[model samples]
Target chain A: MKISLNKKILDKNEECAMQNSEFFADNDILCLNVISSPGSGKTTILSQTIRDLTGEIKIAVIEGDIRTDIDAKKIRAAGASAVQIETKGSCHLSAQQVTGALMAIPAAGMDVIFIENVGNLVCPSDFVLGEDLRVVVLSVPEGDDKPIKYPGTFAKADVILINKIDLIDYIDFSLERVIADIRVVNDKAEILQLSATTGEGMENWYNWLRSKITQ
Target chain B: MHETMVAQSIFESIQQLTNEHNARAVEATISCGQFNPINDEVLNFAFDLIAKGTPCEGMKLNIKHIPLSASCKQCGVRFDYDVYKPGCPDCNSMEFDFKEDAPLLLEEIELEPN
Candidate 1:
């Protein structure tokens, strides 16, 4: 017998993502999903962002990693309620995992919630965690051709952060080329260059976050 | 790998369809966009692992890769863009909307009557 079952394989994940989106909207919380390759300084940028926005806005974090709670601990030390989701060996955090993490953290009174997805340019782009904005970070050391190589992630990004700008003089990273390449795939995404370590160009990032919250 | 998760979802859907029809699945056909970033070889491997001891055991997995099509915003030319370099070929515009297409889809299933 031939069975015609034209269904979406990711329908389950999409359902959970929609539920999470509704929850975030009902609570008036701006949720951001931060994704990047490993060693792209996502945790450092997140920690610094947390510290910078601590007094101004209530913040929380759900850290997704394949192993260890190190990043979650850092987020906690940065003075925000943090939940660490260790995915065992999974490369990305699914919407179901984000929903589970949301129950552990206090949702109300939080102006912003950041879901730091697993460090991967490929798999993480496929999963939507019901975030208001999807941010992808590419550090200066990772070269400017990343957007071309990993178009899926860059195309889905609401904001693209070129981090570690302080190392540009030492490395061969070109901001112009990176922006041009990113524009090819994602013209609508806001591109901002920042050095999370040196705090340079971070004010724009902060302002962007604030504007999102206000909107 | 995330392919494992995707394969599991595919297997589950196949199992449900087979059960609903009271038939044994012989094969399943899946379609994915070129930009989906899934390796078909890895997905088949994962499917085998997840199908063990099930009715779908040893079932063949057929995957059809669909090219990404988009219209150039500036030139209004609709063309199939390469997944690696998704820029508009004629106008070289990166700002274009992707044509409506499913990223991953279970298009059909072949089954043996019980």
Candidate 2:
């Protein structure tokens, strides 16, 4: 006989994500899950944002890496509490892992928490860690066709940041094409162009982030 | 890939369901939407690998592909389209609101009394 279950296969993870979401909501923490490819400057962006908004906003980071805590150390250096989750070989961060990381950090009185997901455009998009916003970073070096190529990730982005804009003149990246492509995949994603290293156009990002915190 | 994790979850769900029903699963059906970037072959292979030595071994895994449906912003026409090439069928407008339901689902399972 055939039994109709009709359950979500990822329900275990989804349930955990819901719990995390409730935790954030109860604490009034604005959680952001950041996803990107290997060299898309996710760490640099978070570090810069932490440094820029150090006093005004209390930001903590849960850094996900395959094996190391290098990014977490950088986040600590930038003056925010950081908890590193080494996934070992997993390509994505699960909600259960985030729960452990959340317990490790002193989450009291924090205005915002950023979950820096594993550097994988595909896997990280599939797993939700109870974040209020999903940020997908596409560097100028990653090409303009990334939105269409990785529609699963781009389509779900709350905000898309085109990092490495300072190298736009030297690289063959098309800013207009990228924006148009992002529109095709996700019409509602707020697109921002900035250089994390050079600090150009970062004020817009900071403003947007601040506005989100207030709301 | 992420499919490995998904497959492991599927295995655990099947194990739990079978245990509750006091039977063994012989076949299973899953539904995946266009928005979900799951490769069926990879998912099947991973499932088989994980199911080995378990009661779910040799179970037939059937996957159903669900296309995403969207409503046009300009013409107000609803249609199904690929996520990669998203556009309205009637108005050809790129602007649309996707009406996709749950992307991945374990729909049913065929069981045998053990």
Candidate 3:
């Protein structure tokens, strides 16, 4: 006999994510899920944002890594509380794991919470961590055709940050072509070009982020 | 690949349902959306590897790859998304949203009483 079991495959994760979302809502927190490939400057962006917004907004981060707490240490040094989750080998951060981190974090009076997802463009796109916004970072060296190659990842982003723009003059990268490609892949994503190293065009990113957080 | 994790999640759900019904699964049907970014062969391989040595061993798996259906934000026309260029077919506008009823679904399971 055929059993009609019309159920979501990632039901467990979805349920956990729902709970996490509600928790954030009740706490009046704005959560951003930061996703990118390795060396896409996710850590640098977070550190800069934390330092820039210090004393103005109370921020914290949930750092997901493959095996080490190095990123978590960096986040703490940036003046925000951080909870490190070592996935051991998992390519993505699941909603369940985020829920655990949420419990571990002292979230009181926090205006913003950033979940620095494991450094992968593809895998993390499938997993939702109950975030208010999905921020995707694509560096200049990664190529202009990346949106076409990882359409799913680009399409899911609420904000697509084009990082390492300081080297754009030296590298064989076309900013215009990348912007057009991103528009094709995701018309809704707010694309920002910045260099974390030089802090060029970072104020736009800061303003965009500030617009999202209430109070 | 995260297909291993996807397969494990699918099997966990199957295992739970099988136990609830007190039956052995013969086959399972799942639907995956185009935007989910899962490879069919890798998903099957991972599922099989995880199901091996378990009661779910030898269970047949069927996957339905679902394409994206998008609606034009400008002209209000609905069309299937083109992988090459996902803009609205009628208005040629890039501002469009796709319908993803669910990214992944375990539709049906064929089972037999032991």
Candidate 4:
């Protein structure tokens, strides 16, 4: 006998993500899920953003890492309330874990909550952590081919940040090629170039964040 | 890898289907999108590791790869293509909405009668 199941494998995660989305909407909070390859400057960009927006907009962070609380500590030191989620070797943060992290953090008055996902372009793209915006960071040193190599991540990004632009003169990275490739996968994604270290082009990023909050 | 989690979900779904029908699943078919980053070889290895010591042990796993397709929002042309080339061939427009053709689906299960 043959039986047809025809069911989605990740339906459980999808359901939990939907619940978290509803919860965020009810609280009037904007949640951003940040994903990228390891050492792509997700933490640095986040720390800088937090510092720039401190006191003006209340922000909280949920840091997802495979082992340590290093990023969480950095986020806290930068001024936002932070909670760490150690996945214990899991490749990605599931929706269930984010739900728990949201409950643990002091989200009462937070205007924005950033879920810094584990630094893996492949796996994190598959999991949704109930976010209003999905941001993918690509550093200049990582080359212009990442969007084509990891299309899944770039395809799902609402915003793509080309970080470490200050090194463009020293490195052989082609900004035009990167933007063209990203456009091939996702035509509507907002692409920005910025250097979190020198703070150059960061105003565009900050302005984009503000626009999202207002929307 | 996360393939283990995906395999576990498939195994659990098979178990539930078997329980409801009062039969044992002998084989299962799964379909996934080309855009999905799942490596079929890795998925099979993970499935075997997870199916051990369970009712789904030794069941044959079959996978169907679905090519990505998109409908051009600008020109209203529907076309199928590889993940490497996401732009529409007819209009050369990147402005398009892709079809959800590559979902990981537990398509069917062949069962043994009680």
Candidate 5:
């Protein structure tokens, strides 16, 4: 009997991602997977979010990076519990790693768990990690052509954060073009334009976030 | 630097196969999907490090390029991928269910005598 080994090898990741989601649901914790290119202001957005919602919503973070405890430290300094998971060299964070990190934090006390994935636009989208929402960050500097260039990331995202709007005037990005392209792939995703540096569209982002957790 | 993971994983698989086969060196032939900014030079450098002096000492590496393919889920139209011209040619709808870059992967290795 010839068995299909190759198919399972390629698909094990997605299966594990689903299992991780079930684990989070059982614990009654809403997880979020944040995906972005390097320096797209993920750490900055997270730092700001942690500051804005710290004690009000007992948060815990499991930071995934190829290397660095910097994000976890920032979240820690923001006055929330944090853990850093170094992928050693993997481009994306696997569900096994996320589930392992979840065990370290007390599930009962935590209202939300944010999995700040490795700074990658493509691979992270393919992996789930049991997130209640998959948020993708695309800064103005990354250009308006990104959604078209990297469709998989845009398609996988539930919310698209067009961050660093303060630099919009300086950059040659067309907000309309970006939205138009994103709408082509994603019809239901909410696009919020904001700057973590300036706190422009953060209110809407916070509301979108809160609504998900409450629901 | 940030490109096809299928290629990256192929490089990893070759280094492992060389060791498991107890080959003195590996002769890898891989079909690289599309012509993106994947630095073959950098991949070779990485592969060298990953396969150094283990079972595979000196190997000839080869990479073949393939183009991107996409099929729109809306009108069910399929075509070769165009980065700048993303919308479906027939429908003119940017809502094409375009597939990301992926090579039709086939790995072949030369083994030394056990």
Candidate 6:
């Protein structure tokens, strides 16, 4: 007799997500799921955050991409243990992928673990990787309407970093619009505007990450 | 799943719904909430195509768009869709209990068997 495979697929994913969450809790590790649209500085922020917090605390990074280990390379270059989760065809990273990456990284001894999600604004918000915090990035080049346009991702974020602030003068991103739109979805999200390239406003993000680990 | 994969799933949703119910389905309804990243326009097209060869061919498919609604575990205020920003609208607290469950639910099946 053939068993129903579709239902099993969903059940497996849920089980994996719960197990991943349990792993994070048992180890007293703080996992951060960082999501953003393509090229919204998810990796760059990971790079910067890793660099700033590296020596002060032992941090590791898990990079999720449909293909390539480029982001993982960047995170590794910034002096941290990095692992890559290649989803291949899956648009978003599941709890299993994240947990698999967690196995690669030494999260038990690390201060913070940043799981950079696949660069899609839509699907990753659905699966939870048992992260202590969820950071969503929106770059200046991505424009202001992203908050409301991809509201689900934004609404799920613990911190909204408006990256690429160095190019604010050159772009059409409206802080007012992003703020207003974010307010409609998440009334009290901490909005931090910074440029990972220039490191102009990187302190707030680092501070936030530190605060989460401390708590 | 890629964009095409999701598109295919939408089509599958329409086909599976009809197959589970009947060959000629009338007034079929589906619900896609704000949380699910589904392209209804494409889903509609997929539904039309799927319905063409099946019993529910040419049957009008209706979709009910569900909004995101969550309640705060601490404050008990239900919030919806905007997951990126759900600090309580009333308390200005960042911790909100989000009610974004399964977005694509086949709520009710309508079939007219001949």
Per-model lDDT: 0.88, 0.89, 0.86, 0.88, 0.74, 0.73
lDDT of 4 by residue, A1-215 (tens): 88887998888998999999998899989999999999999999999999998788889999999999999999999988999999999888999999999878898678899999999989898888789989999999998899988888898899999999999999999999899888777878999999999999999999998899889
Quickly count the clashes in candidate 4.
Answer: 1
Q: For residues A169-190, what per-residue lDDT tens digits would candidate 2 score against the true structure?
A: 8888888878877887687889
Per-candidate count of clashing residue pairs (backbone under 3 Å): 0, 0, 0, 1, 1, 19
Question: Candidate 2: which stretches are off by over 4 Å?
Answer: B74-77, B88-92
B19-51 per-residue lDDT for model 6 (tens digits): 665544565555665655456576667667655
Residue-level lDDT for B109 in candidate 4: 88
Give lDDT: candidate 4, residue A30.
94
Best by lDDT: 2
Q: Worst lDDT window (10 residues) for model 1 chain B?
A: B93-102
Model 3 chain B lowest lDDT segment of ten: B94-103
Task: Quote the positional error of residue B107 for candidate 3 in Å.
Answer: 0.6
| Collision pairs in model 1 | none
For model 4, which pairs clash? Answer: B33-B102
Q: Which segments of model 5 are wrong by more than 4 Å?
A: A1-6, B1-85, B96-114
What fraction of native interface contacts does model 3 preserve? 0.79
Runs in model 1 lying further than 4 Å from the true structure: B73-76, B86-97
Best by TM-score: 2
| Cα lDDT of model 5 by residue, B1-114, tens digit | 333444345545555555565555446665544423245776676666655655544666665555567777678888876655667878776665556665344445565654
Selected candidate, larger DockQ, 4 vs 6:
4
Lowest lDDT block of 10, candidate 6 chain A: A1-10
lDDT digits (tens) for residues B1-114 of candidate 1: 268888989988889877887878898888888657568899989899889888898899999887777888888998887867667888677777777544788889899877
lDDT by residue for model 3 (A27-49), tens: 99999999988999999999998
Going through the candidates in order, their DockQ values are 0.68, 0.74, 0.64, 0.64, 0.12, 0.12
Model 5 pairs in collision = B34-B66
State, as a TM-score between 0 and 1, how close model 5 is to the true structure. 0.71
Query: Residue A159 in candidate 4 has what lDDT?
Result: 93
Residues forming the 10-long window of minimal summed lDDT in candidate 6 chain B? B1-10
